[model samples]
Target chain A: MTDESMTNGTMTKSQRIGEIVETSTTGFVAVSKTLHQPPALGSLVKVQLGGEDYAYGVVAFGTTVSPDPGRRAVPRASDEVYDEAVYARQPQLTRVLHTEFSVVLVGCFEDGSIRQHLPPHPPRLHYDVHECTSDEVRRFSERLVYFRLLLDAQGQVPAEQLLAAHIRQVYRARGHDAAWLERAARQVTSLLRDDYDRMMTVLYGIEP
Target chain B: MARKRLGVVTDGAFNAGLTVRLDPGVSTEEMRIGEFVVVEGEGNRYFSLISDMQLRATDAALLADPPREASPFIAQALRGTTTYATVQVKPMLMMPRGADTDFLVDLEPPQPVRTIPMHFAELHEATESDFGAVFGHEDRTHFAMGKPLTMDIPICINLARLVERSNGVFGQSGTGKSFLVRLLLCGVIESGLAVNLVFDMHDEYAFGKESEDGVFVKGLKHLFGSKLLVYSLDEKAQARGGRGVDVTLQIGLNQIEAEDVLLLAEELNLRATAEANVGLLTDAYGADWLSRFLAMSPTDISAFCEQYGAHEGSLSALQRNLKRIERRPYVVPEAPFSVIDEMVAALDKGQHVILHFGRYDHPLDHMLVANVVTRRVRHLYREKVERYEQTQSPADKPRPLMITIEEAHKFLNPAVSRQTIFGVIARELRKYHVTLTVVDQRPSGIDSEVLSQLGTRITGKLTDERDIEAVLTGVSGRSFLRGTLESLDTREQVLLMGHAVPMPIVVQTRKYDEVFYAALGAGEKRSAQLDIVELFGE
Candidate 1:
């Protein structure tokens, strides 16, 4: 193809991309090749931007449309259908993506194309990292957050996963900075070993 | 005219005597035990009865010259001189019966001694024999006798009369009121004239010295063989193999009318809608409804109400009311229903029923049971009395059902007059041969109206003047015994002042230590011991 034609096509593609981004940010999704539906806020989906795949993004807000028929509209699709596709992909991604993303959903473009958006900045992670000190503390806290989120998503998570994440976080944060790493390590190890103790204590027919 | 010489004895041995010439009007009967007399040669002297007659004369010359200057001839002459004179005697004076008399005598020359009469003083001396004869071994005889039915002091006269006539007891704490009641119970049981039903609050009267065996058990066992029915409202009974006697306790809400239930609900501070719903449920279910109501699952009852288009609030209210009723220990299933029914049945059979409510924690439960039982007995008694008044029968002389409530103030107090069954029994039971024997520490706490109706008053040694005053208001004030009531000590009770006993007399009461000792402290300790045994197997 001629450079001029290629540039024109690229501009058209860029314009289409701009419209998609604008509609997505406005909480709308394209339902068909040419039509759009008003977006439902809190809908989740995946979006591709700058050649990297972002697995989940939530529809944070929906913009009011002008009544004029000439104005191009954005699209919105149901979340139930989107969830099926999302679940079929890497199942572990459900945990990571659910905690990281505000919403997960699917959408169709005007040219019969599909697109996804997964917002990079998860609000919950931001809240946690805001109070973090050293990189080790931040990283450890992130792992702890990840395990907690996983447990929340699954209803019941393995005790080992919780203990491992907890110990790693503590070790990374306090190994060098702590005055007594060996003692702290021993205590943390003992605590991790008795991961199931508290739960058992609560449920072992001991009345509240 | 003649002068008569008379001799008066001073000492029993006649060691010294007085001789005097009588004034003619003096009589021998007029001569007093202690009087002054003078002989012709003797000086003035006092003499008293050694005997009625017999005198050893003293020398008048010795008195005249003070012995130091007396001539031997004059002294001999004074000793031997017995000059005769004309004698005179006065007419005998008459004295009234039961009256005391005093007299004075005077001796002088030429006539018999003159006598003067005076009024006599009355004296009362109580002896140990009197105390020993009335108090008995228990030291609670005065209480048992129910004598001295007065308000001034605690004497056994009123109590004995009260028990004999109306058959009731009253007092205040530390006033030996319970001790009096124990005495009264012994009296009633011993009299063989009437039967007793004791509502023993605090469970004091329930158990004897034998911890495991109690008066309640013994009485029940006597009435119902080895199977003494006991109903416990402890949660431990719900556990497997708990040590509680199994009996059916069906509480009939229908026994009380809707208005009455509402009134009770209002009094209890229950929700209006709940009260209304309970009233409706009770009306629908009738007397046996409580059984079905308790048997129904909570969810089922809720669903049933919903099916009938009842609001959730009303349904919830009904459930709450049921729960409130169920929460009472007495209302728990496996309670002694049959025992109560048997007691009622025994009343119908003209047999006496004694409910020994030994040391129980909830005095109100005793009151409640008293209320229910009294209500039922009163109803039956009314029917019988009415029937008898219409047509007299040999078997129908007021069935003679006596209800003896220990710690009566707890139930029949005017302050918390909740119209319990006991209140009805107290008010109306008397007319139908159902007499109430209200026993309590504080007689002042008992309702005056009920207290007044108790024709017989049994008063024991009451230290509280107020309680004594409360009791004394029920008796006649005309008797001389009223004045002496204050002098009465413990175990010396005034009896039969009320209509029951013909006369007020101090009588000794029989001892029933088994029943009395059981009524001492709160009965909860026994139940606690039983609880420990069941819970810890100790």
Candidate 2:
């Protein structure tokens, strides 16, 4: 079936977040000039350059790094002082530091269909990145094939953790339908029969 | 254009098997072990049976990671991300050149599938045509033994493949081996494929036996109608006070052979000297020797033995063994019914016979009568084979005869297999239009050679590992089927395999109700049935 049908024709303009800074065939790194908080480690991220043409990816790794290579010393606000207070206290830090997260390219919505693999080309430079609409994530996840890409991904963060974070973000996005949650949990047991601890952790992530 | 897309193949060793990452909508309950499924590949569809299953996270590490308690956010994170179900399938058949074709050719020769199609779908549960092709069409002789565990598809067994050689019905006690044999016999009678002469030791097959709950279970005669002619010693009829006897069979001393008396040595507890003389006496006095030898006086016996070059002590010992048979009232010098001639005549007219023990259900009585009747039946069948061979015409060939012997190990045990006629029939009676349906509880006790020769085996629950292994003797894939047989339900369910069925399968035995009797294609079911519906309606 076509992605148009899969989206149920409800996909509108998604929330623009950042711009692409570095890219590769399997994954890419993007930097937002200032961010309240980085997108959760494994949330779905989209990079679209034009109409109906986009690359979909999972947030495999995320961190806030200073933009300039020299002078790596960055100010830190202690836990007692929260986001608004830290921003007020260190205005200079915001211009120097940017929240950067890496994305493992999972699939593409190209030629009007959802493709569960690396797209033919990387998104053009400086293309606006967005948090896929809840409906878009739901449609992309109707089949869980993309998780295989996340599992196959080789990155600094553990695939299991990234997978756990991805499921959590999707669950929060999709209204947390209990039946769907139960079904997804069942799917977890099937894929993780061995290595009980890892399965337990994954189950732990989905326990609500 | 339309089908339930099950999954996509991935991450499997092409040589070992195929692994399917199931689709999200497909639940865990669908992929069962031993279930048949069809994999859609390029230019062909492969038929496979699921052997093993697993569910796990995409990352191996996530499976064991825990804080002992699940975090709500973490739990939702794990839901659709890392977890999936995979089924391990062993491909059995491949319809090469097209995915839609139903011809099931072998998947052997080890063709390497370096990659699958872009449109590869893991598999869906096999359709009816797929199962029908694999199990074969049910013809007149093709009756379903039971339904497969995956679905309600009947597992049909070809009786022709079965009756061509010896067969065995084996299970532990109360495992419904008798009922399985009864169903098989019904198939045999319905197809008119063979005539069965059952030597009923428990007398349960010819006459209904009372269940523990005080219900009377119908016997084979009721289901078979006129097709089954029953022969008994008339003791049960006498006890029933003129309830009637179908054919009063009296095994007079005239029908006793020297071999029959020799078979009784163990039960009679006679010395080996007596067995030696019994063999000599058969050569000396011939077929009617039992009564003749018993008639001799002690002095006359010694004189006759001395003249015949036999030991005097041995002759007296043989005389002692002679008394066990001489004392039985049923073994008269003559009887109204001749067991051998009547059996041959009934078989010639295409009638199945059941020889009941009446009051003499002892091992000794059963063995003696079985030895006598089967011996004569074997000889008659051999004669008919000779006539057919000489005539070289299908019309001259006698109808195939299958003899049902309960407590088979007694007659076909390793030690007795060397000495008994039943053992030879068990091993070497595929030809001569004769076969045997040997029933026993401890199949381990039967001769391994005879057990291996069985063409079809219908076994219920057997707890003993040796009994289970012994049942799987000649069959292939012993290791694969061990768990299945070990877990059999100890009731009407049975594991039927061998020449009859297309594959090893467990089936819930068909009910022996009015429908069963009706399926036999006979007239009214016999008088033994309790018609609750008729009584209530009236």
Candidate 3:
């Protein structure tokens, strides 16, 4: 698919996954349109800020909670009613329990090439988050500098597991580029020098 | 193979040498001690030797708990980054980088390392040109001794510098010390830099002898023919169908001096009083003392001792020791027409002489004969040198002479080095146009003063620490070279150091097989034609 948007400067509606609910320089929280589902953990997602400028992030954490902080949802499913069937039974439950995921700002695509660093500005609130195309994932993973940001990200999910899952996703997106996998592993190894235990943990977690 | 980048200089000192951290791709297993290396600094290139190596890790815990055997990826990633190898390179010499051309290099020779390469200088496996530039190429004055330990390039030694002073060849028995000495003799003969007087104790250098591999290796006589002369001390053995002998060496009893007997005090089991009695006997009987003392009965010795104011017991013991020299077949009361004069005349005419001991290979026999012959030759050389100084005529000048002696410690130990002719030649350098090539297994037994005066020392593997220390006496940067010397291969490898080489190096000695025979035989033919032209005045 073409990286450039139509004349409207917006991604197609089918490609949209969520809208930015809260924004910060380092990260943002996006609420998914589907109930109890945010983008798969560590998957690449992007938000466009008009024209060809876009901000990128890796899905760091996900949770489904009540819309209000004070509100608590009561147990309503029985032995026969669970999973999708229970969700189908309670139509209003989907609206009350919103699914939101946190995204750590990795880099941005501005001017012409992908910059493997934090965006110049935080993406505006309420902007649509889109699932990047296979070509974008291949292009972005080419420069692995952003690996440091993911490794240093502070979140409930351990950094090693988060980076490993993201690499697995990118590996598949890039049609199983084995050479790139080794380069990515070596890059992480160099950054974690002297931290032998942590380096091994990441290396073992990312084994193809 | 192409020259490979091995590592980078990370840490070191001028005295201790530089520490090089291996590059991410280079393997530690491939680095060998005594191998040559070059460090490319900002403006200079330092030629060095790999003296030591160590394996290091970024974290101690990584060594304690290495990656599991099943996980190759963790091991591979940790190899060049977290855990790596470092080699200790002893920088021997340094030269500026722009002196790449041969003409420029000759103009600016490498100097002893006074400073270390800067931190992080690139290190590489030494190339052939590096060996050529440092050790020089084979020519009239330089002889290709051997190749460096890990390279195919020949490492040359300056024959002119080698013959300028006394030299040594040392190693334990069967470590190829004799083979190395033979190669050196061939080089000296081929270069025609100096004439040689070899005391061949085992009869190996004169006539071809069977090697350990059952192959008959050719000797100097076979290669040089008429240009070399073989003198046999055992006429009977020479008569038993062997290579032709030019002369039968016979030492008249009257020719044996008191100094020659005193030099063999230990070999003949003489006491302190023997020295004083020998002096009295020499003062009384002059040059005929050895024969007269041997002819005396116990009563006659007592009468002579009483009249000469010498102890009768010392004189009796001296007579007993004198008997051992008289029993040798070559020793006689008189005749044989001044054999010393003949050998000296041969040496003066630019012919190499090898005095094969034949059956008298015992240390006592070798010691007595070598000392007697060398003393007389040394005296003749001294007179010739004095005559040349007085007359200032080219005809009176003495030709340069190199005396090669095996079991050198017997004549050069602390007790006799001050009086033996070999020790005197060693200390005098080339003053009387005389030098010595001492070959021995127990260099430790050699006097420290004499050992220090050695110009070039080619040593094979030595197991004795004291012998090693003695060989390296008075040498600079000896501690670093000790490791290289100790790491030498047991056969055909030697550590060449001192005046003859620009820097200390370990080399795989050239083989003394048919290939060497071919090289020497060719040189002999050229010299032979020149000799014929000179004789005919064409």
Candidate 4:
């Protein structure tokens, strides 16, 4: 259950959609789908920061609708809007994944564009958006593959592989050029490896 | 022919019949009662009396048979009128072994048929000389009778006699008192009729060691071998320290009466108000009052008493009394503390038990041992009586348990004793088949009432006048011989004569070998010296 509803406070976009995933000080992926925005909330998004690929996260919360005429008009969908047509197109989708993913809230700029808040060190890093049919998201969430892997591995991922995958996926999905992706990946790989290695070792012991 | 003398048989064995011809020279007055007479055809010489005489006319027809042989001379003797004189013929006239005595009387005589008074006479003489010769034989010897008569004659009559009644052995020191006691106990055990318990005070009765002959020697050996359970108060005291305390002090004071406290105070001579306050406290707070009193500071309970002017000293005295009472020691037999209950259980199962308290210290230790034993015996008897009454069956024969208390005077003290365990035994043990065999040197020191209750008294020689007097008074008159009372030497005892002995007799006590008697007074002085040495040595 969302903290807003539990504590009798005004509902946030993520809380209106589903439960909130509270995070510790450590970085974690946010669910960004089934939230305030329709296609964006329902989409699978890859965030490449410091040349490291984080596992898929759904659109958790949509940006507030802007009154400015230059901003693109995003679909104004309630909880019932995705009932038949969206679900019929995604047969493998289940309600638990929608509920789990829908609680995440993504940041937005005042101009009503998605914010570019990637880690500054890897300047060429980009966001990759995959229009995850409800089936894919449901299958991913249901498998809890990455969560199980993180738990089994005690919360550590290989730095070089993660950075390479992140850059490649972001470039492919956002139609970014391979040259910039390769250069960014190359530069950040070594540094990310060291940083990730040190951070993971300190946070979770080296055995994991 | 002369008138014939008549003859009649007297004793059956003297079967000879005598026909004494009436001769004028003889007279009938010389005949006697026990004279032997002889007659023809009788086997032996017979003595006769002229029982009856009659004169009748001659009947010629009755004389049918002719005389087998011609009759001998008719010798006539003068007798009174109607005289049919009896005369036993001489033994030479008999035919042989089987001849019968016969007498012939002639109706007509050559002189005249004159009647004379009848007389019976023996044909042969039996004189005083004959008697002396037959009965008196100089070579024979007479059997010797028992000892000379005395007041203890009755006691001797019952010597080695089984006494089912409880007996007590009492006397003063140097009286060979324990010797007498040991003799009585050995008698009872040897009789194989009764089981006995000896509350051995000095351990004198404890049996061990051997004789030269290797007779599995006696003393208390039988008791020890049997179900005897020895409870040594001295050992207990040593094991527990002199501070051996009875746990009964923990019994709730609520169960105790005000009178009990008063009696206890009176025994200890505590102040009256203290006793009263004890009762009051006991009544108010119950058993925990002592703990509560102890919890109070100043070690005094009077301050806590709401009553005004109930003296503090009395209260302090009461506190001291309470502490002493709490410290009174007890002997917990392998069985339960209730001796009578344990005894009854043992008795009901026909178990023989010996409670040996041989190693106890002097006085109070003796008292405690006596008390425990007597209490158990009395309890068993009472239980049996109750059971008999309830069942109304003849099957219940209340078998008595013999409880022997050595050094009895210490525990059975009459003048000053109050509510002691031994006192109960002394008073009520008889009804329960609990017979007390009190063995003590100072018989006078024991209570008169308790001494009176002892049925059989086996008194050894008593030197002390007072102890002898106590014993004399306790024993019945029949048992007290004049000289025996004043001066009975050692090892010589007048037995029975008390309530316990059915008969009074003086008996030479069977001597036990020196080893058994040596146990008494052996270590006492040496132990005292050793104790002193240890105390000074430290």
Most accurate candidate by TM-score = 3
Q: Over the true interface residues, superposed, what is the Cα RMSD of model 1?
A: 63.8
Predicted complex 2: DockQ: 0.19
DockQ of candidate 4 (2 decimals): 0.00
TM-score of chain A of each: 0.22, 0.83, 0.92, 0.29
1 or 4, which is superior by lDDT? Answer: 4
| Highest DockQ model number | 3
lDDT of 3 by residue, B358-394 (tens): 9889887898888888888899999999999999998
Give one digit per residue, the lDDT tens place, for model 1 in B471-523: 66666432233333343445433333465433344333433444433532233
Could you tell me the interface RMSD of model 3?
Answer: 1.4
lDDT digits (tens) for residues A1-208 of candidate 4: 1222212122111122222233322223333345334433224443333222222343433333322436554443457666466646555443322322221222211122223232222212122233433332333332222321222221234433332333343344444554443333323322323243332222222110
- Candidate 3: which stretches are off by over 4 Å? A1-16, A33-40, A49-53, A66-76, A91-94, A110-114, A132-144, A170-182, B68-70, B99-107, B335-337, B391-397, B533-538
Q: TM-score of predicted model 2? A: 0.75
Which wins on TM-score, candidate 1 or candidate 3?
3
lDDT of 3 by residue, A63-145 (tens): 98997989988888899998788889988888789999999999987776678899989999999898887777887888899
Compute each candidate's TM-score over C-alphas: 0.39, 0.75, 0.92, 0.39
What candidate 1 gets wrong by more than 4 Å, as runs, is A1-208, B1-167, B210-322, B329-341, B348-351, B356-360, B396-398, B415-418, B460-469, B476-497, B501-538
Clashes of each: 75, 38, 0, 65
Q: Which 10-residue span in candidate 3 chain B carries the lowest summed lDDT?
A: B99-108
* CA lDDT, candidate 3, residue B464: 88
